[model samples]
Target: MKQPLRLHTPRLILRDFQREDSEAVLAYQSKPAYLEHYERPAPTREEARAFVDMLCRWAEEQPRAKYQLAITLDGGQVMGTCGVRKAAPGDTVAEYGCELDPACWKHGYALEASRHLLTWSFETLGVRKLFALTRPQNLSAIRLAEALGFHRVEDGRYELTCP
Candidate 1:
């Protein structure tokens, strides 16, 4: 995608990550619940800053292969992050992922944001196939992916193909 990219849902706005989002990203990522499904360590302040910077840099690339955006609630509050990323530029296949704050869980924000992300991927990004890898224990993510029409093609991996 390109700069100023934004996707809207009934209750959320998936917009490009700004430099000011670093603090909110850091705040949620520092919580234990954020890393419950993943084995990676919690992000330090510097790591969070670097991540935001990377997202911003990716937005500016000439042939961008990634679209990781901050999930905000109706133009306010950074609730989480969502992305649809091609494995390589010009590839028709891509993978998607989303991370919502623990507090935002159960509100269906992830599902809403993810559906919008996939639509943009298929229609705007020309992605013909999309997949997601979620930890088995993360049932919420599994359900969200399924709701978006992805089926389990292998252990911990789900996929959907555009019609």
Candidate 2:
């Protein structure tokens, strides 16, 4: 709901994206592993800048429908982004997901950040259900979803209902 929005876990902070985060985002986004399942080509510097600007703009909305945050270590080096977004203000359901730098993969950062995002979405945002749409071949994402207590609702769709 504000510029400095943040959610915390034991090992990380999920904070609002800042302009300075553009370069880090670009660097990770350029990796072959990161792009493996994505259809779009790697982003240019200007595209990355615009993307961060858009996240900042979304944060400024009156009844924010999205929380696209930067995932950072406690020491403040950003590793990736995570988000839970409703289709409209006051919706009881949202879509959520996270991505980390390829180098950070398998280290549990995505799991840690996603667990915190799920909690924040359910508690702070009043969301009753959170769903993730992962690519069919993204086995790591599938495993992470299952590990977090999300059940497969349908092909490519996994869901976690609030307790």
Candidate 3:
């Protein structure tokens, strides 16, 4: 099956990553607020390019193991990213991750984009289970996951089992 490059919601579009998005992504992730909960330091532009390139490669591979979609406003401004990566062998699960521009916080974009991905995971990818991990102190992310119907499965881990 061909993986869709763009998913539409009322207010956002989750589309494929592009070189042009590097600057916008860097603008958000480079901030201290955005990187505070991340274990690694904020990435430089070069690092972001390398990261995007890797994601693009994965998206192109057959039996794609990752879906790295750029979260954009309806007007097409790069606002964040939302995607899923294959879980490790024996896990039979996939992990979801997202990062949004601080300027776009509190607008429900994360939850909307997450719901879209969860639907794709279950209906399109035929994934049986999905999960996410976030810093416990990151209340916003935690709330967003819960709102997307992912329950707390363990410390820093939330899960949604397909019905």
For all candidates, what are the clash counts? 0, 0, 0
Candidate order by TM-score, decreasing, is 2, 1, 3
**Model 2 regions lying over 4 Å from their true place:** 1-3
**Candidate 3: tens digits of C-alpha lDDT, residues 1-163:** 4564888988888888877678777788888888887888889899988887777777777767788789988848788889888854334578889888888898888889989888887887777888899899999989898888889989899998886
**lDDT minimum window of 10 residues, candidate 3:** 84-93
TM-score of predicted structure 2? 0.95
Better structure of 2 and 3 per TM-score: 2
lDDT of 1 by residue, 1-117 (tens): 444888889989999888889889988987888888878888888999999999998787778899998999989979899998886779999888999899899988988898888
Worst 10 residues of 2 by lDDT: 1-10
User: Which model is ahead, 2 or 3, in terms of lDDT?
Assistant: 2
**Candidate 1 lDDT score at position 143:** 88
- lDDT for residue 109 in candidate 1, whole number 0-100: 91
